[model samples]
Target: MYPGVNMDMEMQNVGSNGSEAAARQMATTTGNGEGHTHRGPQSAETGSLLQAQCNGGSVEMKSDRRVLALRGPQDSTICRMQKELKDVVCWKIPLWMLLLFLLLIMVAIVFITLALCPVFHQDVDEKFDPSTFNISRLFKGNFSLLDLPFSDDLLVPSSNQSRALSRDLQGKLTVVYSSSPALSRYFSKAEVHAFRNGSVVAEYRLTFLMPEQQEEQLRRFTLSREMVYNVLRQSLHQQEDHGTYIDPLSLTLV
Candidate 1:
């Protein structure tokens, strides 16, 4: 009985030892599997972080390139020139318009002033006067002679002498010789004859007696129709019953 008991106890002890070793080996295998899983996740996270850093660096490089392009010298100069040109155009247009408006205003003022006031005026003292002339010889007789009494100072030849007549009857004149010293020294003669239809004498001959020595000068003298009209008009204006004033400057020849 004692030997059987000893063999059973030894078998029990050996089984117990084998079970404990198996349990320890299984725990070590489970611990190794957990460590491998943790390592796999950490490596994947590191790789992802590296890729993100590369993308960020590429974006920053692109932004730097864009900033460098905008800061170039030629582009900056062009922008400044465009700005200055716009400012000049904005100022110059109004300036030119203002100048033109001022010029137009000056022109208008000049025209208005000229129209309001004249620089020349007519004189009253230089009016024509013919109160002392005889004018009845134009319609009197067939050979009636009318005499004109002119001032001696006006008829005497002197320096700056200017004289005119209203007729050219030198070739048709009948020469009459007179011996009057007053007539020779002072007065000249002019004769006017009026005809009817180029045949008969209409009224008479009017004569102004002058010196015989002045006959050569009288032959060359001629007068315009305006002078004749002036004389007639002045004579008519100075009539005894009907006197009127006439402005000499108002007479126009043409």
Candidate 2:
């Protein structure tokens, strides 16, 4: 071979070796830059280093380096941030919806209770007056005395002796008239009075036993005007002494 050809071949070999060494150095620098470039501020430094290396490098190699350097860390960071934002949104949306749903349910319950609940309004009589009412006006009349047949002097019993005369009269009346077995339970007390015609008459008052249902039964089944007159006539006749006379035509009930 000629001396010039040998020299040209040697220069080509040296240039190819230099290009290989530059590519190796650029690759090493790109790896180190990727480790350091974690944020946006560090990207400018990495880009500046790659641009400086690309000043003498091939166009395709420089473009490939730029693509690799920008794509690796930046895309990974952007994707991670997007995923975190999506997760935050997912958590917040459900929480807000749940709170709104609970509030709506509470509102619905209150509305239903108010709508369905009953309202009572009591009616008052406009003509009624409480202060003008008198209880004593109801008992203005006196009880009528029943005239009964007798054979003995019928003395008037004193009204001030509590219940002694009344109880004795009740026992005599119950024992004399046996047609009614439970008649004694109705006679609460008796009052005696002397008339101008020398006639003594008795007025018997009634009282009901406890539990008002029993009182209703007694009033319905046991009490009558005729029955009272017969019982009083028989009872008085049994305790007579033949000195008194009772008129049967004067018998009346009040």
Candidate 3:
């Protein structure tokens, strides 16, 4: 062989052997215990330069290096963050605290159900009882009977003149007076006066049937007109003496 050709071949073989040895050294130094590879600063720069020269361009090498540099640090940071989050989430809550939280949730649910559900609402409307409400107000001059619930059943006097007394002393009579226009035509002035004074000639007797064990029992009561008048007079006097009206139904007549 020619001396010049022999020198050229020797130089080429030395260059290839040097490149292979450098690659092997880099691979060995950058390997992790788990057999994964990482790039050290020196090895990464040298490898990129060598790759750029072999591939005939610096642009591809620079792009690849930038991508590797960004991907490696970002992925490692993200994985570490995920592991920390998992560790935090694995921590157990105390039994007492968990029960307390559940109890609070149950209470909230009950309150929401009560506020939003219509099933618990009362269906019966409140009724106005005339026995409990004002009754003496009807006797007042400016009072209108139209506002009363029992206005249709009451009778008003036609004339303001008193009636003559009956000759029969033992004969009992019924007298009713009301402010209702429909029944007023049937009443005399004397009857209206008696009603206002809480007195009437009529007497009444009441009876009650009560269930006792498996059988029913009868109880009788005899209420005279004078006794009824006395109770009414006393109730009216009490209403006048005190500013408050008493409920007639609350009185135990039996």
- In order of listing, the candidates' clash counts read 1, 5, 2
| TM-score for candidate 2, residues paired by index | 0.26
* lDDT: the better of candidates 2 and 3: 2
Candidate 1 displacement at residue 209 in angstroms: 19
Give the RMSD in angstroms, all C-alphas superposed, for model 2.
22.5
- The numbered model that scores best in lDDT is 2
Ranking by TM-score: 2, 1, 3
On residues 1-102, what C-alpha lDDT tens digit does candidate 2 reach at each position?
599999999999999999999999999998789856654655655554342234223222243245433234556677776665455334466544665678
lDDT of 2 at 153: 33
TM-score of 3: 0.18
Tens digits of per-residue lDDT, candidate 3, 142-228, equal 111111132211223332221211111111112222232222222222212211222222112222112232121111111233443
What lDDT is obtained when candidate 2 is compared to the true structure? 0.47
- Candidate 1 per-residue C-alpha lDDT over 117-161 given as tens digits, one digit per residue, 9 for 90 to 100: 654545553332333322221212232112322333323324121
| lDDT order of candidates, top first | 2, 1, 3
- TM-score, per-candidate, Cα-based: 0.20, 0.26, 0.18
Best by TM-score: 2
